[model samples]
Target: MHLNYTVGYIIPIVLDALKDTELSGDWWDIQPGVVRLCGDTVEERTKNMDKTTRRWREAQRFEILSGWRDEIYTVYAPKGSPFFYMERSAHPLFGVLAYGSHMTVYVPATPTTPLRIWVPRRAAGKATYPGMLDNTVAGGMGNGAGPWECIIKEAGEEASLEESLVRAKAKPVGFVSYFYVRHKEAGGEAGLLQPEIEYCYDMAVEAPDSGGPTLKPCDGEVAVHILMDIDEVVANLKNGKFKPNCSAVLLDFFIRHGIITAENEPDYLEIYTRLHRRLEFPTR
Candidate 1:
């Protein structure tokens, strides 16, 4: 199963929900309306929406962000009886769950010098996942857009990557299943890489630090980033890893597509052995 690649083309990215570090974009209503909220309580914020907030308003763009809209990269309408909407000019979505696109870096297994993948550390902010973890690049729904283009744009934002960089050595593989809620506050420094929102997309690069003359980051979304070894990432994942999309879908995709024959593929061959057992990792 050779992993089918998308045509050599790139899409514009808007920010939303993602879990990777090397991507450019923003999450939900956290964008242009990321105000200080001069008030003390949610009620105050709602009131402010009516009077002030010269930029945002309900039933419109601002309202679009109210409440959590996605989780683990999956969109979900508010469940059960919610405690009042988050205000239409409100993003009523809860800010407790995890929602966004994500990428996992890895060096290919091949003769001679196979590539290695590293998922550098994101900045120390409200969005960085539990302390720090290895994730490729993930972003939000980019105002309800698709994930393919989203991932590409995210790689540029978080990784300070240029389209030309990944284009030279990257290609998108099949996607995985990522089911989640809508109002979950992603773990990381809450902010956007570019000025606009973004969608989610996943791709494979030849190396972590792969860059070119056309790639650069205008916004200070990502800190110093780097690419590391997949063996270390897999080991870390096996030992209470932060996010396992790397092991869950990415690795499997590579194998399914016949990209490389991992030496330790058998030990992790539980899909066929335990087809009836439940899984314990994120998808898509």
Candidate 2:
């Protein structure tokens, strides 16, 4: 995929931060200023990067905690093992697009029924993408949690779902990946490099009238829960009403469910390939 000029510009800044670090990789001319950390083991990489992040934090004064939980996410090898740890806030500056997972719960459409998906509205005061539409339950993979673990925790925290229910119903379908470069919010400060991959899941839920399970925002992250028909969801996606990354996940859902197909979408192949772009990172 072709990146925009902004992403091209930020690549070198992230590489420069690694100068003098013990990361074992060619510093210069590695994919045009992109630094790939090659390490002997997870422990070694984690220790080295931890020191790098601390020094970078002190030297740059970058805000350390900026997410919903102000947590630290373990940077992982492509196979999903911990490589290092870094504060969520500093990820963008380093061009490290952290991995996350989310689930979309839906009532399946039958011959007589219509497909409907659960969408959550982020709280207006969210530090990022406030008031935008999001998946039913979404959270980043932290230092100690894998994708499944993270989703279960997010389900309970964001939607008050019981672990037993989520564990029983959620199925790991696939993933949607994208690279986004965000410009600075104000002034001339550097912008963020966000290359994200969402491990997407799907869960079948009882229809609203049946009251199979009630979804309420147990935490302050969400403002409300909404059940919208698949058509409406697609419309919102086209209108850019959903969070950009969330939109990619929803589009993947539609493609998998046959709601979108090659015959209908002119750019089906391109969209399909881009949604699962192969990152340089190791992913299991």
Instruction: Identify the candidate with maximal lDDT.
Output: 2
User: What is the C-alpha lDDT profile of model 2 across 212-251, one tens digit per residue?
Assistant: 7878999998999998888889888888778877888888
Instruction: For candidate 2, give the lDDT of residue 115.
Output: 96
List the candidate 2 regions with Cα displacement exceeding 4 Å: 1-70, 77-81, 183-191
**lDDT per residue as tens, model 1, 1-284:** 12121111111211222111222112112324231222334344334433332223232233334332332222122332111112221222222112245565455655765445545544555242433553566665434345556666777877666667555545555444332222223331233111111122344545323442222233455444555555565566567544333344444444554543546466445542331222232112
Model 2 error, position 245 (Å)? 0.8
> lDDT for every model?
0.39, 0.72
Candidate 1 Cα misplacement greater than 4 A, ranges = 1-101, 104-106, 110-114, 167-169, 178-221, 244-254, 257-284
Model 1, residue 210: displacement in angstroms? Answer: 9.6
TM-score of 1: 0.46
In Å, residue 200's CA in model 1 sits off its true spot by: 8.8
C-alpha lDDT of candidate 2 relative to the true structure: 0.72
What lDDT does candidate 2 reach at residue 131? 85
